[model samples]
Target: MRKRFVMLTSASAGALMLALAAPAMAAPEADTIVTFDVTAGSLDITAPAGPVDLGDGAPGSTITNQLGVVAVSDTRGGATSVWDATVYSTAFTNGALTIPVGAVSYWSGDSLPGSETGGGTFTPGQPTTDDQVPLTGTAITAIPAFSHSGGTGGSTASWNPTLVVRVPITAQLGTYTGTVTHQVA
Candidate 1:
């Protein structure tokens, strides 16, 4: 009887040891997830400084001046790849001595101050309406779009445009002023 009791107790202890040694079921693999989101970048432009102050000119004389256009990217995602510059002009008026928009022409050259290296090809603009025209000449009629190549730091570029106005000998003698508008995209 004593031997049987000892054997039973040993069997019970072995069973308890085996149960404790078995591996846990991995706790059902508790899982957690993470995520990230980003927003799109944007573009911006600065209009040329005004009162360009052409000073004075004689009849048939060509008055020359320059305006600078600057483009910038906020770089939210990356550098801007390309951009376009659009320009237009309102008729010049010295209290109604009207100077038609056709009298003006513009051309661009050299990366002006604050401009990046990837200078772009420029197409002249033409008179398209009483109030609007391209920046270059009548032939192109559209502002030339440029690449951000040439290492423009992926964010900013600038241009300088020389504007020419032929003052008709008939232009009534007085101070004249007009509005030139610029847009970028």
Candidate 2:
């Protein structure tokens, strides 16, 4: 009986050692989904700070001046992003002496040196002096963001425009003031 009891105890001890030596069974893994969100940005435009000054001219003569730098910045990111910049003007009047809006011509020359940044294509509304369009109280495109080759980035474009005014052959002479407005979308 003593011998049998010793053999049974030895077998139990061997089984316990084997169990401790082997790796434990792994628990089932649980998965947690991860996620995030990104919001859209904004598009904006900056016009030159000025009351643009077109120098003096005699009656029936044409007066000209530079409207300074006009800029458009697009923060809205997309591969095919686009926008347009339009310009409008208020008639120039100096107490009874007036310059009609139709007499004002705008020439958006080109993007200034190093003024165009980011990625995309910028098209000037008036590429040259000959392309100048008259202001008739209606908004005309000053610049157009036609295409974007970049993957998902913003773009900017800026240009200096020339304003030409035709002084009517009337008999009044005074300093004329007018408002030129620029808008973008």
Q: Number of backbone collisions per candidate, in order?
A: 7, 0
- Per-prediction TM-score, please? 0.58, 0.72
Give the top-scoring candidate (lDDT).
2
lDDT (0-100) at residue 48 of candidate 2? 76
lDDT of 1 by residue, 1-185 (tens): 99999999999999999999999776856888988877665667676567777667987897876655544443434443455666667778899688877787655554546556333333223222232223443323545433343233235656656667888878878878887766655
lDDT for each candidate structure: 0.60, 0.77
Displacement of residue 75 (Cα, Å) in model 1 is 3.4
**Ten contiguous residues with the weakest lDDT in model 2:** 142-151
Estimate, for each residue in 106-144, the C-alpha lDDT of model 2 and write its tens digit.
887878888777755677788888888887575653333
Pairs in clash, predicted candidate 2 = none
